[model samples]
Structure formats: structure tokens, C-alpha cells
Target: MGPVSSRKQSIVFIGGGPGGYESALVAAQLGADVTVVDRDGLGGAAVLTDCVPSKALIATSDFMSRFKAAGRLGVGFEGTGDDQHAEAHLSAVNRRILTLAKAQSRDIQAQVESVGGRVIQGTGRISGPREVEVTPDDGEARTLKADMVLVSVGCTPRVLPSAMPDGERILTWQQIYDLQELPEHLIVVGSGVTGAELAHAYLGLGCEVTLVSSRDRVLPGEDADAATVIENVFRRRGMKVLNRSRASGARRDGDGVVVSLEDGREVHGSHVLLAVGGIPQTSGLGLEEAGVEVNDGGYIQVDRVSRTAAPGIYAAGDCTGILPLASVAAMQGRTAVAHFLGDHVAPLNLRGVCANIFTDPEIATVGYSQADIESGKADGRIVTLPLSTNPRAKMRNINDGFVKLFARPGSNTVIGGVVVAPQASEMIYPIGVAVQNRLTAEQLASTFSVYPSMSGSIGEAARRLHSLES
Candidate 1:
């Protein structure tokens, strides 16, 4: 669609996430007219506010969790040496969070620029069918022509107006870093992954924490047994978990915030973190006017290849209501470009994608789960091996989590696996590869694992399934 007059079949990407920038880079390399317009930095929410920063903070919090068990490992600490040493440790962690956030943002920007893509920092909206109107930095408005428009605007933290984030006492997930000092009595209102994660992070950092959940358990969306383990761990750490509770409002006290529940329960803390959920950043983007199909929940509706109902308009990442992860977003973007350029495009297979909640006793899952199979949602067999019996887990005094594997009944080919323990995110990679390649449990069991290692539990799980099949 290269034009004779003024156009070059422009490909305009309307966000800067893994999805947005990756596609922009690919299309640019393929000689398409590429421009990415975003309101904030090039990396969007994941790099700037959510994933990178949250993971950075989690790094220190993970250390705190390990420190609590150091005594069991014959490691002694003499009360941090002094008060000055304690303060130094806290400040070091805080500074590292900010440093990593900025560095990750810069790296994403550099990736886009290196690929010959134009990055315009502004709020972009669909002005017409093939044009995106952007308000430039200095308040100048410009319309960017597009032969194909890709919306990858990602998501925003959902906030209830009744309990809005003041960014001081009360804060959204994005506002967590603004605290000058550690939160004493950090009350997190929401018991999903985000809520559970922050509550655990603060609790590990020695903050008295309470978790509020409107459901019967934390991580209501996860496997029931996995959620139970996390809840027990939270309680063991002295976290006050208020299940079946809803937050009515929040108010700033003299030095803290008081959260009122619908059942007349009051939880007080130095800070309030609203871990409710996320909503797509779709409003005011001129989506409806351009006839792009949007789901009832306001997410852009697209096929597996990321093509929307509207002609020449595609969406990816969180905006498409697909699996919300930096990795998923990047793949979606690349696939959309492949389809647009008339190249062979494999439809997105979300089954093998791994999603990990970076919390103490981290939860990681790829593909199917035992619960999903038993409930008839999927067809598979489940074999679980407790870590208590694993040699490495016994050596580490770790008796909490287990490796649960799911595979087809007769063939015994691995379909999915879940790991619920420290560093489970990193350990779940082998299961991801096994599922992707349709490897049998017997083959996984045959692979050797280093003796006296946590990863040996993975091979043990596979061996258990092999025994069941025999």
C-alpha cells in the first residue's frame, strides 16, 4: 500500500509495551512506515510502573524472606549491627527499586530507536479510520496517518472512586514507590495475586500487614489447594487476612490510613494499597467511533492473531484482553505484523505461557493444572509429589509446597505443571518446555537432575507420574 502521493502504508502502533515496541521494531525492519505514539515513556506501564518496578522491589523482599530462615541454616545475625546499619539496608533496597525501574525504561526506549521506529511521546487517539491524533509534549496536536493501526495501550490499576488513591496515605499499585519510609501496618485491600504479593512483601520487610479479601481465600482465581497453602503461610507470618470482607472506604488518620469494611470492620495502617485489579486503558481512545469491536468489559476484541473486526486495525497485549504479560504482548505484536505483511503467521498458543506471582512461596504455572483436569475443564491425569520427601527440600527444611504435574492419561505426555515454592518461577521453565514439545513424563524422569538440588523435585514429580502409568 505504498502511496503515489503522500503515504507509505503507514503502520502506527499506539502504545509502548512488549507488544507495541516489538511489533514496531519488526515492521520497521520489514520496511513498513512505523511510528509509535504513547502518553508516557516508550515501555508503557509494564516497564515504568508495574512489572519492572514491582519485580525490583520483590528482589529485596525475597531477601527478607530468606533472612528469616537464615537462623535455621546456621547463619547468625547480630541485630543488623546497629540502627544506622538497619536504615542503610532499607534505603539501599528502596534506591535499587528506582534505579532498576529507570534503567529498564531506558533499555526499552533504546530497543525501539535502534530499529528505526519513530517514537512520539503523547496521548494518541483514533481521529479517523486510518489516522491517530496525538497531543504532542508542548500541547501541539498532530495527526499521524496509518495504513494499519495497532492498539496496545495496555491497562491501568482499577480504582473505586469511593476509595481513591491519594498517592500519600492511600495508593494504587502505581503509587507504591512514593513512600519515603517503610509502611508500618500496611493494610492491603484485595486478596488476589497483587494484594497477596504486596502484603507478603511488606510483612517480610517487618511491616505489620493485613490482607482483605471479599472471597473465602487469597488468590481466589488460582488452584484451591495452592491458595490454601498461601493463606496458611500468610497467617503463620502473622498477617491478618480478612476473608469475605469488602472495603467500604478509606481515610487518612494522623499518621496512617484507616480502612472501613462493609461489615463494620476497621483496619488501620500507615499506608493503604488498593490491589483490586486492572482495567484496560481504552476509554477516550476513539475506539468506538472508529467501529472497532470492544467487549462488554471495555477490552478490545481481537482474534488469536490479534486482528480486530475493524479493517486495518489490530490490538494486542492487555488491551486485547489476552494473557497479560510482557512476553505475551511481544509475541502478539510480532504475530499481528506477520499476518499484516502476508507472511505465515502461527496463531497465538497461550497454553505454554508461564505466569508467576512473585510472592513468598511463589506460585508459577504453565499450561494445565490438576484441578482443571479433575473438574473436567481439560482432559489429563494428575500426579503430585510433595517437596517434603525431596532430598533438597528436606535439607533446606522446606516442607510446604509440591510439584503437581498434568498429562494425557494414556500417552502420559506432559501438558502442564505447577510449582509452589521459592523460585518456582524459574523452576517452572522446564515444565513449560515439556508442555510446548509434548514430552512424556517418562522422558522428563529420565533426564538427570543434580543431587541435593531443589530442581530434583521436578524430576521426582515426573518419575511419580511414570510409576502411575506403569
Candidate 2:
């Protein structure tokens, strides 16, 4: 930690998610008297329920995937293939998941406190400009004055009125880990990133999985080609994927749950997990009364610098209706703090932000998409190289996925790229740098990558793009 400057300003952050706590730490380091008021535990839903929990389970899912393919890799086990009993010890997994989440929450809390920021475990609402009212869990409400305020109240899962979760047979994504037994047949609704990842995870864990999508394909908002590849992989793994089916309602019947589609079709499973989407948690927080602007959907309206309509009040993260990513939230928080402290700050530019979807063949993309090129919004040429051609993929017996690169039409400067492979999350960083820093395809091609590596495909794709100019 650097030395705190003598200059001091009081800063209050509402919500203890990545955006709120991360910014509070920065504010404290900048010599501000910073305090965070949070309703939930530190680290927010991203840590306690959603992102961290899902990824931990995915790590196990990835191992199971590898275990199933051991025979192809010439790796042998003592038991016969048919006699193998590799059931998931779900109770044990849940215990580990909760342990990891709680540890992370405590770690984040420690980080904030170590940097001199005080944390109040309570619900905070804006009483007025520069004033926050905090209601503690077991105490009377108290008011705190601040020179600046950051509202980062994140979001909660959206549930259809007819399909409310019972927490036993029908569960939200947050409620799944509480179950002591693995779902015999898991029916996952909504084929977005959350639904796809969980469906893949449970399927890899040796359970029967069904994925229902309202759109024509899974991951409807994702890159079309990437979505197609994943949907194919889902079906190939014996997971039932029902596309063009909009779920109207879900109900518990006997020992099972049935999700009814709009067209009158019904899918039955031992359990139903809803991953429809999320609604911003900005309502009834004294926002409207404080004269801060929130949209019809309850998302706080903010400028690129994260300022709200009311003076001295700023907003960030999912609640602001910007890009709903953890990294984006952190950057927004830092930007809000810098601006509040009278320091020079650049407004957020979300164009080059990298996003990854964790599935069997993970999907990672940065900057412009294939849709942008076709729509003429971006004047770029695209080149793709399948991972099957890479020596590492062959050595590993991995035959799926590709690396797609995009370059400007004239100078061939790399503007965007996507990677679909196992651990695509890690492989996408170099391409992210190329896009973020405006590095040209020629520059990427010039870079050296180890032979028999998955990353070699990235350089090769750029090399191919460079060849078009010759």
C-alpha cells in the first residue's frame, strides 16, 4: 500500500460487491475516509452465490470431462468401462463450494479493512445528497454524512410469476448448492451463459441434463458460431437441448418438477434450475426520492464517468445497467472513486472488454463481433483457424473449437478476436491485449508461441489474416 495523502474526503459506498468494496479500498488508499454499507456479506452475490460458485463447480466438471476421455488418451483404469461408478459426491461438493465462497468473502473484507476502509454490515439507502442511512442487522438505524457516495447495489435473479422457485424441487441458481443430493434429472431453463454452464456441469457430473432455450439456439446473445459449437457439444454428450421453446411456467408434481412451454409441451425432471436473467436491485433504496435517475427497469442511469442525476452521488456495476461483468464493475468503481477525489479519470470504454463463458469448450471474445462486421458497423476482415489443425489439440485428442480473428480492412490492425477451446478463458488474454492496445495482425503474427501449443493457433490465425494483404 502506498502512503495516504493528507487530503481527506469522506466517501460512502452502498453495497459490498466487487464494485462497492473495490472502490472503497481505492478511496481509502487515496486518503479518503471510506465506509461501505452492505446488506449481504462482503463480495456480493458474484462471490457468495453466482460467479465463484459456478466456476468452482465447473472446475470439477472439467476434470470429469477429462476422466471420461481417458480411454482415448490411452489412460486406463482398473474397472471395466461399464462397471465404472464415478458418481458425483454432491453433498461433499456443496460443502467445499460454500467453504470457498465464505473464505473469499472474508478475504475481501480483510482487504478493505487492511486498507483503512470501514465496513458496516447493513442496508444503506440515500437519505439525501451526501447522506446515507444505514440499518444494521441488530441495531437501530444510523445516519452518516459523506462528501461522495457510490451506489453499487447489484442485481437478483429474475423469476417468472408462474414459475417461482419452491427451493426444493424448483430452485434458482443460488439455491442449488443447498441441496444435499445430486439432481437425478436436472432441467435447466434459459440457455444463456448461466444455464449453459450449469447444464454442462451437471451433465459432466454424470446426471441427466435438459437445457431449454426460448431462442432458436442456446447462448442466444453470444456469438452465433460459438453458440452453435456449444449446442452441438451439448447434444453430442447426450444432454437434451430443447430450442425454440419458451417456458411459460414450472410447478412441482409428485417427486418431480415439470416446466411447461408456451406451446403446451411439458418437460419433466427431478429438479428445475431457473437461469432466466437478473433484475437490478435499485428499487426502494431512496433513489427516486433522492432525485437520482433510474430507468424503467430499475437500473440506475449513469454517465460514462459513473455519475448519477443527483450531485455527489454516483453509481456503478450491474445496478447501473452497463456491461454486467465483474471486471467492468471493478473498473467502474475505480473510475468513480478517482472522479470523486478530484483526480483525472478516463470515462469507461466498454468496447474492448473481454468476456468469457465457461463451458466444456469455453467461449471467450473481445471487441467487435461477427455481427458487427456483417452489419457494416465495423469495416474489418475476419479469419478463422480451427483448433483441430493445432498440434496440441491433436496431442491432447481435443478436436473441437477454433480461433477467430478480426482485422481492419485497410491497415489490418487487429480489432477483435474470439477463442473457443478448453480453457479459452486463459487463451483469450493475448488477443484481448491486441484489441485493447490496437496491435496489428502483423504484430501478432510476428510474436513467437511455443510449438505444440493451443496458443499457436492464435498467432497462426493472425498470420493468415496478414497473408490477405500480400
Candidate 3:
């Protein structure tokens, strides 16, 4: 045999989602022999199926929304009738969405390979603390040895036994892209981010959407003020908002599906999309056998540094049961690799992470939350400004949504904030920066912003909080 290579500390990552691939790339950069085992294609479910595809459809939906409003802005369309009809060819839209997702996956694969990381398309299971068994789709199984192992198996959409996805009328969020035509009467079960987003998108695409919420509001998990605004917006757009209704089961009724609520009410629709949540994909990986601790839901218990109970093994992403954001997964992966490689590392700080809900008027939140203040967990002052009052809002004919800012009482330190408006996803970045850097409200107020802009409201809110301090 030739001379042994110097890079002997091998790192094996099971799953190629944001968490797995990110860690693998980091480990490779740190001079470790890294291998990523992915059963699905490179970018995992987040890119290949869930996040990317949904956002692509949302983009189309957003365009249609703008097009519909263009008429009010002195922009008229040719061959217009009393009822302007615009149908979304879901097949064509879905084809474009998948194409974009697959392209991104290939780009990620190229990036990982360029960094000297090996990616294997196979299902990987931890056979031991430092060994993984990879079963390739077309080839035979093989055992790979590693100095350290990172499990980032991600998760699958949770489906109730009573409402299994038929890939036809009844569908999960993933099965939606396969639909050949737009749903005439789409019934979305669950009022979480996924449900609310798709309901909004379909409604914008001119479909009659009925949103079923087990809770009182559309987005029960989000900021209360933000959820209320989105729920109102949904109703104004002619979408049926059903509250306090829990789906017991979904069954085919004649040519359509009927969602039976726990309260004995049945809602009929051409198609039903289940957005209950996700179940961690941690089983069948020999985790418990190898002394890796898992919770009741099968999610691996991990520390801030992404370390599991077992030494030389770690877990990240949805499998860790941490905040199930793609950004958090990436951070956890990076932290895991940094710790494993003896590099300077810091525990993941979730408080600074920003999350967005993609609706017609998007809802974005960062840092601390109002619940913290109400519960006395955090002492802060809040100021909310309606976007309707902004000059930019008048020009764009965007009347709904608001900007809410929270600051610590004495120091006026900007801790958390919420933005509900068009392009709120893009607008929340500055707040994320301020929260991460611990910038005070005074500092934000002193900063100048462009006149007649939505972002100006953020600065204006900061100014109001600063004046309160004076």
C-alpha cells in the first residue's frame, strides 16, 4: 500500500439536508475526511421538496396578487371582462418549481464536492458509535468507519392514520406539486405556518380556500398580533376561515374529499392538504443501541454544541427537536463541525434567529417575543406602528400590517421586533442584526432611512421608543 494520508480523522454525516451537508462541508474544510450519506438527493427534503417548492409556488402567487392589484394603479389588462379570470396551470407551475429545487440541489452537491467532501446517495444507519452502514439504492450495502458521526436525518410530515395521503384528492404538503390541475375547492387542515401559507397562496391564485384551524387564530404558534392581522387579511380575500375546528378524519365523498371535524361538522372540498407538523426521522438508526439518547418523539437529545449523550456522536436539525428552522439547522451543523475539529466554537444562540411566514402580507419576527414580556420573563417596552400610516403604504395601496418594536425599559436596547407587511422577510434582517449585535433603540433612531419606504417605519418605531426613554 502507498503511504497513508495525513487526514485520518473521518467524519460521516447521515442525511444531506441543510444540517448534514453544512456540517460535512465544514468538516471537509477543517481537513477531515468527510462523507455525506443521503438517501434522497443532495439538498434533502428542505430544498428538494418542502421549503424550496413551497416558496416557488408562493412566488407565483405573489405575482398574481400584484397583477390583480395593478388595475387599481391605472394599469389595465387587454381583453378584460367584468370578471377577470386568471387560471394557474398547476402542472406548468409545479414543473418550474421542481426544476428550480433540483437545480439548487445540484448546486449544493457541487459546492460540497469542491470542498473535498464525498456524497453518497444511500440510506445511512449508525451501526455503532463510530461506524455507519450505508445501503445504496442500486448497489450493495457497505460499512464505513469514522472518527465522529453526525446524525441529521431530518423529519417527515406527520399524517394521521385517518387521513392518509392518497397523492390524489387527499395530499400532504409534499404531494401538492404532483397535482395536475389547480384545486377548485382546496381545504387546508391545520393553521400553522405551512397551512396558513398555502391557504393564502391558493386564495391569491383565485381558488376558494377554506382554512381549518384547531386554535382560535390562523397562526397560533406565531405572534398574536401578527396572527390576527393575517387571519383578517385571509377573510377579506374571500377565503373561509374556520376556527376552533379540529379535523378528526378525511375521507373521499363521491368525487371529493370531506374533512370531518371533531365536533361532528363535515367540510367538503375538491382536495385537502394536511399540514399538521412533522415527525422526527430518528428511528431504525440504532441510536439507542449505541447509547445515544432519544426523546419520546424519537428526536435525539442534543446539547447546545450539537452533542448527544454518547461521546464521538452528535445530532442536529429537526432530528434534534430544536427550533425546526432551516437556518437553525445550518447553524447547529456548523457548530457541530467546529466543536468536533477543536476549533473555536460558540453554542447556538436561538434568540437572534429570525423566522418568517410567507403569506400575502408576510409575518416576520426576530429576537425576543411579546409572550416573554407578558410572562415577565423579559422586561421591555413595545411600540407598534400601522403600515397604513406610512407614505409608502399609500403609494403601494398596501393598507394592512404593522411594525412592532420592543426595547428594554432603561437602556432602550432593541431586543425583539415583528414586521407584518409585503416583503417582511426582507425587512426583518435589520432587526435580526440589531438583536444579534445588542444594538440599542437610540442607535437605530439615529440611523437615517430612505423617505417613503416600508423600512422607514422600523427606524420610526425605534425613534418613538427612544423618545419614551427621554
Clash counts for all predictions: 0, 0, 0
The positional error of residue 102 in candidate 3, measured at the CA in angstroms, is 0.9
Of 1 and 3, the candidate ranking higher by TM-score: 3
What local distance difference test score does each model get? 0.85, 0.91, 0.91
Query: Stretches of candidate 1 above 4 Å error?
Result: 1-9, 78-92
Model 3 misplaced stretches (Cα beyond 4 Å)? 1-7, 79-84
Q: lDDT tens string, model 2, 9-54?
A: 8999999998999889888878899899988788999899999999
Residues 1-470 of candidate 3 have per-residue lDDT tens digits of 11134656899999999999988887887788889999888878889888899988999998888888887899877785777655688899999999999999999999999999998988988897689999988899999998899999899999989999999999999899898888899999999999999999889887899999999888998899999999998998899999999999999887899999999999999999999999999989989998999999989999999999998899989989899888899899989988877877889999899999999899999988999999999999999999989999899999889999999999899999999999999999989999999999989888888997999999999999998999
State model 3's lDDT: 0.91
Query: For candidate 2, what is the TM-score?
Result: 0.98
Candidate 1 lDDT, 1-470, residue by residue in tens: 32232434589998988889988988877767888887788778888888888877877777767766877989766755544222215566767787777787778778888878888888889999788898878778988888888999999999878788999889998988877688878889999878888888888878889898999999998877778888998899899999999999888889888999999978888889999889998999999999898988899999989998888899999888888788999999998987887656889999889989888788899998767787898898887777788888878778788888898889999999989887899999999999999999999999999998888989988998888889
TM-scores, all models, native as reference: 0.94, 0.98, 0.97
Q: Higher-lDDT candidate among 1 and 2?
A: 2
